[model samples]
Target: MKGNVNSPLHSDYLNNKMKSVQRRHSELKHATPHKLRHTRATLAKQAGTSIEAISEALTHSDTITTKTYVNASNVIPMAVGEIAYRNLKK
Candidate 1:
């Protein structure tokens, strides 16, 4: 699964790594590259990261696609924007 110098890691490599992890951790049996990406996006959203930032981080051309990655039901109850703003002020 090794890639040539300067080349991106193949999806198969990541998938294999994920499978190995799942073998060791039964709780992660449902994990996959796409699921991991979605989880990261949701976490970033819950952490008060701007949607545009998340979209850019995910290399999405439009926020609409990134929106689907975020799990709205898992959002924090606090004001995420306010928390982010306060962090910026610090």
Candidate 2:
């Protein structure tokens, strides 16, 4: 209140005013957007979301890219993951 609104001290207040408005939005200060994208695609695949849909959601030009993301945690994609699960159920 001591300084004019145009003064340097007031500028700091203006700069941080928007920050105090929201507390939950700061969680991304440490988030990895790319890793979240890959994890979401992989989980969607496990939940049986269509590959074409996952590709479109990821803005990928090819479904192969989505498949790569979904299978990044494994090797050989369904050839390994699906076969292992299927054999386990037998």
Residue 6, model 1, lDDT: 43
Candidate 1 clashes between residue pairs 3 or more apart in a chain or in different chains: none
- Models 1 onward score TM values of 0.75, 0.45
**For each candidate, what is the lDDT?**
0.86, 0.66
In the range 1-90, model 1's lDDT, one tens digit per residue, is 255654566799989998898889987558888998999999888878889999998889999999999999997845867776867997
Q: Identify the runs in model 1 with alpha carbons over 4 angstroms from their true place.
A: 1-7, 77-90
- Model 2 lDDT per residue over 1-90, tens place: 565643344545644654564355775443344566787898767655678998987889999777778865553345556756766898
Pick the lDDT winner: 1
Residue 64 in candidate 1, Cα distance off native in Å? 0.7
Residue 71, candidate 1: C-alpha displacement in angstroms = 0.7
Looking at model 1, report the run of 10 residues with the lowest lDDT sum: 1-10
| Prediction 1 TM-score vs. true | 0.75
Model 1, residue 25: C-alpha shift (Å): 1.4
Model 2 CA deviation exceeding 4 Å by range: 1-31, 72-90
**Candidate 2 TM-score versus the reference:** 0.45
* Clash list (residue pairs), candidate 2: none
